[model samples]
Target chain A: MIELTINNIKVKAEEGMTILEAAKTVGISVPTLCHLKDLNPTGACRICVVEVEGFKNLIPSCAYPVSEGMVVDTNSNRVRRSRKTIVELLVENHPQDCLICVRNKNCELQDLSERYSVREHRFAGESKNHAIDISSASLERDPAKCILCGRCVRICNEVQKVGAIDFVNRGFSSIVTTPYNKGLNVSDCILCGQCIIVCPTAALREKSSLKIVTNTLASKTKYAVVQIAPAVRASLGEEYNMPAGTDVTGKLVSGLRRLGFKKVFDTNFAADLTIMEEATELIHRVQKNENLPLFTSCCPGWVKYAEGKHPEILDNISTCKSPHEMEGAVLKSYYARKMGLKPEDIFVVSIMPCTVKKYESARSELSKDSIPDVDAVITTRELVRLFNMAGVDFTDLPDDEFDNPLGESTGAAAIFGTSGGVMEAALRSAVFLITGKNSDNIEYTEIRGNRDIKESTLKIGDLELNVAVVNGIGNVETMIKKINSGEKKYHFIEVMACPGGCINGGGQPIHQKTENVIKRVKALYEIDRLATSRRSHENEAVKTIYKEYFEEPGSHLAHEILHTEYFDRSR
Target chain B: MNTNVLEKFPQNDRSALIPLLQEIQENYGYLPEEVLQQAADHVGMPLCTVYGVATFYNQFRLIPLGENVIRVCRGTACHVKSSANILFALETALNIKAGQTTRDKLFSLEVVSCIGACSIAPVISVNDEYFGRLAVKDIDKIVKKYSARKVSVSTANENQES
Candidate 1:
């Protein structure tokens, strides 16, 4: 431990802890813009400058280590002046369009400017004006708003391992961009959107479908239907004053209904359907001994990454459409047939905790007759914006249930929002399919939590099942290497592109603290615990859908709608 | 297409990136996007980082190089000697601004900070050969000589091709 006097408050901090972190322990909040938690510090942004007694110049507290008997004043006149100067310089170059920015009140820069009480720009210079890039359907990049914090660049290159974008050029001409400033669509971006979440300003954001959904709702000729993903339910409450992981599924339904949606449905229902088809497929693959390790295709980001970076393993990925895609297909086909409406007349909008789903919805494979299965994909953040824009009293709204047959789901489906959830959900039913009875133990506790890679082996009656789960795309390379080297063998693998699964998805509310993600994960687990039917096979609506329409889980009709193919997009 | 430039560097060795990029710039005059991507792949670095490093160093250029390059020094000594006027004079003569190449690719202009020959104030280096103690009137003479040389070089290339 190291001793430090921060603002005359003597404290002992752990060795190697930065002055910013030590100050944080003592509740001395030093504002920072470029320090990503657990990632290597860049200290590019000099916002957290502090006055150390021995140091000649104001040191960046975030990058400076706390030393024994170090005298530090975080908000001293000298430090405050330096920090304010930094903010002034950043603001001078930045655009003055914060009111119309997507990140408005939630922006870190705005918060810092307000904290520092920076009312006037002292350093006036020629501001940079760059064209806003809306080339990718999933994300938007406004280079003019970027403060050159390099947070997004680091996240993309280091954490996500995509390297889709980077800081190009030097000095005044420096900007974060793809190679040659080309559109992101041409780059190897998986569209996971981790960069958007890390962005301190409105520079990086998901391309919003809020306006389109509003137009669709207002259109008299179109019947707009919306489906909410499981992760959306787990984290949507954070947008409001409600605490993180406060499952507002019922309130979310009420809010969406107030948004003027014709019908509200749950993607969890399709998650159950995914389990039915995927479990049966796994059973067949296990018996036939073909495609030994079947990789889950639920995450569109992971799917795109696999296709582009590792096309050799494309065949190993499950052919089933993602839950939301499956829901859209079923809504267009089965639900449309039941409602006596043409597929073209019904517009489907999915409220997803994913930005990649926007790109996935536009893919040609997930469409029929040139009509996309999902017409629009709005993120959980966009849903909050819609709620706020429509003046919906989300907190006061009564708990409302989801509509009809497509809304009903099981506890196994509810757990699909977190890491290792798909595998656990599938195993609950896969064990039943192989042994004609549910597993005595339902919770696959071995494969739970935020671990990057998780694997477990179990004996289901006569068959030994081997399964693995990968949450972040960065953790996938090692697993693929093991599979190729014949060192690790598995019959099934579940991969969620975002770390800690969909609850911490890129499209969810931005959280700097890890506790919010944990709470969201716990909330999904709580839903599973409280649910009546804990297995996908036990979902009566799913069973009815199979018996009355598809005939069987992997029947020809089910394959036509639920199953999809992948392509080799390796560069 | 000259992947052989990357062959000297060990695969996945990030330390080899600077040397490899230096060699690329030495061989190709400017780093091409395709070659930069290949260097990124060979060095196991992100393409953006490769571009970042290349741009951070003023020695590297992204666009195609012209036949004759003119680098105007804007060092303290040169600035004191009114190098800005000489830069403007050159820009007018070449019909291009600093950090740009002429449409005919005969000459390119770049304003640099110190080429380490401060003894010769207001130095202008054309293709690594330094000319010192020059005035605004000297810009036209220098540009005309480079233009004349470019014509002869092209004529020789045309003769060889025929």
Candidate 2:
């Protein structure tokens, strides 16, 4: 430990900690742009500069390692000037189109500019002239607004292990681009949108389908139905000033009702359906001696990554669409048929905590009868915007339940929001299906946690089942390499693209503190523990759907509606 | 088109084009068009896109016959110390531009964004070897060492053939 004095306040901080970190430890606020917790400190932006008693010039507190007996002035005139100058320089190149930007009020750069009181940019020069590239199905890139903080590059390279982007040119011409400036759709990018989440400015954004959603809602011809994902309930409350991990499922259901939708449903219902079909497929694969190591296909980002980088494992990936898409398909087809409404009249919208879900909805193969499964997709952040725009008092709204049979879900479905939840959910059903007996023990403690890579083996009746769960794309790369080297042995695998699965998804609530992620994940498990139907098979709604509609699990009719295929994408 | 020449190398497995391109550049002087074309066929990529990528990065080249490659540093310290001017002088003396090899098969000139040897500003490297504290006159002496070696190799080959 080291002792330091910041702004005349004596503080004790850990050794090897940066000044910004030490200041934070002492409750001294330090603004930063490119410094993300648990990621490398690039110190590219000079927003966190501070004055040292012995140093000649102001130093960036984010990158400067603290020393013993260091005296720092965090709010001195010199420090303030350095921060202001950095903000002014950033504003000079930034676009003046803030009112229309997707991240208008939520933008970090705009918030910092207001806090620093940057009234005018003295250095008026020509900004970098680059066209906005919306070539990818999920993401948009506006290089003109990029401040070159390298957050996207770092996230893509360090976190995802997909080095599709890098610093290309030098100095003034320096730009972040894929190799040969190929569009992201044509590049090796998996469309995870982790880059979009970390970007402090409007340089990266999800491709909005808001206009299509609004059009559907406006038309009297179509009946707009919406479904909210499990992760969305745990995160939507954060935008309404609620604490992290607050379960707002009731409020979210009521809020969607206020949004003029004909029905408000839950993706968890379809998540239960996914478990039924996926577990049955695993048992069939084990029985038929075909496509062993059945990989979970619920995460679109992981599905895309597996398709592009490890195409040889296509046969191993399960043939099921994600719960969001599955619910869309089911709503437009099954629900539409049951209600005596045309499939075209039912505008299926999914409120997902994922940007890749947007891309998944647009896949050509997802269409059942020349109509896209989901009419439009919106993020939880966008849903909050819609609620506020409609003058809905989200905080004061009464708790309401999701509508009808389609809205019902199990506790196993709720846990799908967090990491290892899918594997645990699948195991619960797999053991029952394999042994033809309900095991008293449901929780697979070996496969449940926030670990990057987790693997376990168990004896289910006469068969030995091995399973592996990978959370983070970078960890998936390591696991893939081990599998390719013939060192990994597993009968089933679950991979989520984000670091902690859909609970901490890229489209989830954005919090600066790292602890908030853990808090949100904890809240999901708590929701799972408090529920009566702890297993997917135990959910009466799921049993009713199968007995009334599909007849049996893994039936040909069920496969046609629930399953999809993957293609190899080489770069 | 010569199978024997192609078979002489094992690392030239067409499946590994990008890495093989880097390796061939490291071993040979530069990536000739023929070598790049062979790599394009191996990787099943169009020759145009391969050439486009080779030209996109400052790291690649398409010429041949350079005994020693010279890379003048252009890091922050070196830039402040006018190392760019040193590079200009080397480009003029060798009569070959940056990322290009001389027609006489003597030297290849290149410029790097950084060498990471900041304390010794105005640095350059010859054939993967570092040379610091460079001056305008140093270009002449550096060129002579490689030219002399090239002359001996050609003469030795001719004598053995005769």
Model 2, span A1-571: residue lDDT tens: 8998999999898888999999988799999988877777888888899999889988899999998899999999878888888889888988888998878887888988899898876999988998888898788889888888888888887788776677766677677777556687877677877888788887888887777887788899999999988888888878888898899998888888887899998899999999999999999998887887899999998988888778899999999988988888888777888899998888899998888888888899898878988878888777877887789999999999989788988889998988789989988888887777878887778777778898898788778888889988889868877777887567899999988888777776555666777878878888888988888888787798788788888898788888889998754
Per-residue error for B74 in candidate 2, Å, reads 15
DockQ values, each candidate: 0.73, 0.06
Number of the predicted model whose DockQ against the real structure is largest: 1
User: What's model 2's overall lDDT?
Assistant: 0.83
Best by TM-score: 1
Interface RMSD of 1: 0.9
- Binned by DockQ into CAPRI classes (incorrect, acceptable, medium, high), candidate 2 is incorrect
Residue A15 shift from truth in candidate 1, angstroms: 2.1
Residue B11, candidate 1: Cα error in Å is 1.8
Candidate 1, which segments miss by more than 4 Å at Cα? B1-3, B92-97, B115-120, B128-133, B148-162
